[model samples]
Target: MNKVLLQWALFSFMFGLALSLPLAAIHYQKNSSFKGIFTNYRKLKSAHLDYFMQALSAAFVYLIGFAAHIEFAAYILIPFIFGVILNPTILLLEATPYIRSGWIRFIYRCLRATSPASLLFAWLAIAFLFLPTYMTIILLAVILISGIGILTFLIKRRSRNEVGVKITEIE
Candidate 1:
């Protein structure tokens, strides 16, 4: 009954459960010293919630599909595994001291560059399941804008480094 899919689904679920540790801390620390732990606590919480929900949903879908003898369950797992599991895992890792190391930062940058493509494709697949074509188009545009924004930020950061001038603040 597709044991491999079942195993991955369970793994996703466990990872979601693990995320609750940080989620609880974020919630409890919103007004305290630990509030500064995350640069954008609200956004982190939102992303964490998204990952938990999507992983939970994927687990259920996989379980149900296996029981029902459906062969298409793997397709449903792909997007959630990528967007929910992989993306948020990397974001969470950003909070670690080791992530600041050159190789780790490089990997993070590469992921930042490529993640939008994975997310866009995943969104496209999910949109086909539940969204109108027009809405899907709008989502695609949003994805494009987000990708452009990331690229712009990276280019600006690189250029700034190259110039040997640090602008404390720019508006």
Candidate 2:
């Protein structure tokens, strides 16, 4: 079940990335006033970029969870996937011509205010409301620590590689 979910997440991410080309072309034709091939249609451009990034981020999270054999796959992965899909779906709707309508703009405004990170936090908030508070806090802390560790390791590795290259050039 987890494997299937991860596969679906990968597919969704690729689909989101694939969506950018056609949307870019449409933007170019419809909203371009900047003497370029793409639109200055800021909101629409933002929608496509945000959707693609959110899907990609969700896929990354799913991959990490799968690789680590995390026990809470359903809890974490499901919300990530659902939010990734829903956020972009809302943005895509906003990209349509009817955004001038007050209701649609309002919806867009609300969703746009919350990014992928905030969506994850919102899930955490919901979980905290329902589940044991300690469990939620521990889970969040683990994720935070893991993120920091990974980033630190990556930075050190990058610096090491750069030093190695410099040494080789000098010798």
Best by TM-score: 1
lDDT of 2 by residue, 1-171 (tens): 456555665665676777677666675666534324222345556766776677666566546546666534355656555677667666566556655668877776766665455567645754564557788789889989999999999999999999999999999
Candidate 1: C-alpha lDDT: 0.63
Clashing pairs in 2: none
Q: Which tens-of-lDDT digit does each residue in 1-171 have in candidate 1?
A: 345545655666677677667667767766654446555555566556656665665566566556666555455456545654567656665654546778978877877766656755655665565567898789889989999999999999999786655454341
Structural similarity to truth (TM-score) of each candidate: 0.50, 0.48
Q: In model 1, what lDDT does residue 143 have?
A: 83
Q: Which residue runs does candidate 2 get wrong by more than 4 Å?
A: 27-40, 99-118, 122-171
Candidate 1 vs. true structure, TM-score? 0.50
**Predicted candidate 2: what Cα RMSD to the true structure?**
12.5
Flag regions of model 1 displaced more than 4 Å.
Answer: 1-6, 22-47, 60-70, 73-80, 126-171
